[model samples]
Target: METIGKGGFCKVKEADVRVFRELLKKSTGERVEVTGMQHMAVKVFNRNVLKGQKTSEFDPFTGCLKMSDQLQSIMEEIKVWERNSNPNIVKIFKLYNDPTVPEMYLLMEKAQYGQIQIDLEGGDYLTKRNAEIEVVAVAKAGVHWPQGSGTDLEKASKWIFYQVAMAMEYLHSELKISHRDLKHQ
Candidate 1:
């Protein structure tokens, strides 16, 4: 079986439940449940594009989008956890390599709750009231200050900015890698 995603990659059926379950146990070092299982994504790389590819810096939105290269980028992201640990970042569990197909599968921790970013900013997705309610809830959750006194939103925002800057500083100065894309999302 095969499946495709918009502007992404192709995927083929990798394994059935029994084999996959055993594979997950071996990889994760723990018994786990895999649900909504589907074909693993495989990048289709172009030789012509590879010929001129010399830089790591590339526009993610436009011009000769290479799926294979993007998969490599994702792999690099997984590798970063080996060196640095950050609570804000997502954890990648394992990497599955299929020599026959030349495809890699990244098994990651699945979040039971839907992404807040998608809930809030998903295209034409949030209605007015929903946005307002989410904003209020976030605002309430964000408050922190002197023992009892509640901090203002600006203060909270500044604190968040500082924490993020600290993380970037550590990454750049210590890890020697630039985040490149740093924006409030």
Candidate 2:
């Protein structure tokens, strides 16, 4: 078996880098490089391409889907660790994709530290020790650090619930926007 790196997946090699670059070129038509060891997660979408006008794919009033819509949806989500703007939110960043390989590449901010995944099958899994370590690390990293240092279990849980509620409230009370998937990983 291959040795697992700190990121949990198999160690990423030079070939992996090449493949990723190729994918980006094919998808967004841009040549880019992975600048650092930080985790800059990239998400690619396989949305339809229409040459003409853009239109809403779904009805605004009713939450329904239609088969006859001319436009197709191809949206991808890429999240990166950003400098801390808020204590409650971990980190968020914006990315730009290569226009040529538009579907393939999204160059994003890199987060030096890894992420913690909460398995939903069981109860809360983050131990106090881990929380304490993360808190201290963030504290030492300084408050103004643009790419925030870290987040604890309590903050993450609260943020998730709040974000979900706000999203739901927005859907019901504000403009209609469809979110196809909402998975943690």
C-alpha lDDT score of every prediction, in listed order: 0.48, 0.39
lDDT, candidate 2, 1-185, per-residue tens:
11112121112122244565676579658665565433444433322332232545455568875443222322212221232333333333334533454243233333333333433433355422234334444455344222543444445455445655676555444433344544342
lDDT of 1 by residue, 1-185 (tens): 22221122333233454565677578656554555643233233333333344446445567654444545565465577456665544344455554455445544433222233333343444523333323444464575333334345456556556656788887887777788656443
Model 2 has an lDDT value of 0.39
C-alpha lDDT (0 to 100) for residue 28 of candidate 1: 51
Top model by lDDT, which number? Answer: 1
Q: Summing lDDT over every window of 10 consecutive residues in candidate 2, give the lowest-scoring window.
A: 1-10
Model 1 bad stretches (over 4 Å): 1-68, 101-103, 109-116, 119-121, 124-151
TM-scores for the candidates: 0.46, 0.33
Candidate 1: 10-residue stretch with minimal lDDT: 1-10
Report lDDT (Cα) of residue 162, candidate 1. 63
Instruction: Output the lDDT of residue 129, model 1.
Output: 33
Off by over 4 Å in 2: 1-39, 44-57, 61-64, 68-71, 75-103, 110-115, 118-156, 159-180
Residue pairs with backbone atoms closer than 3 Å in model 1 (clashes): none
Clashes of 1: 0
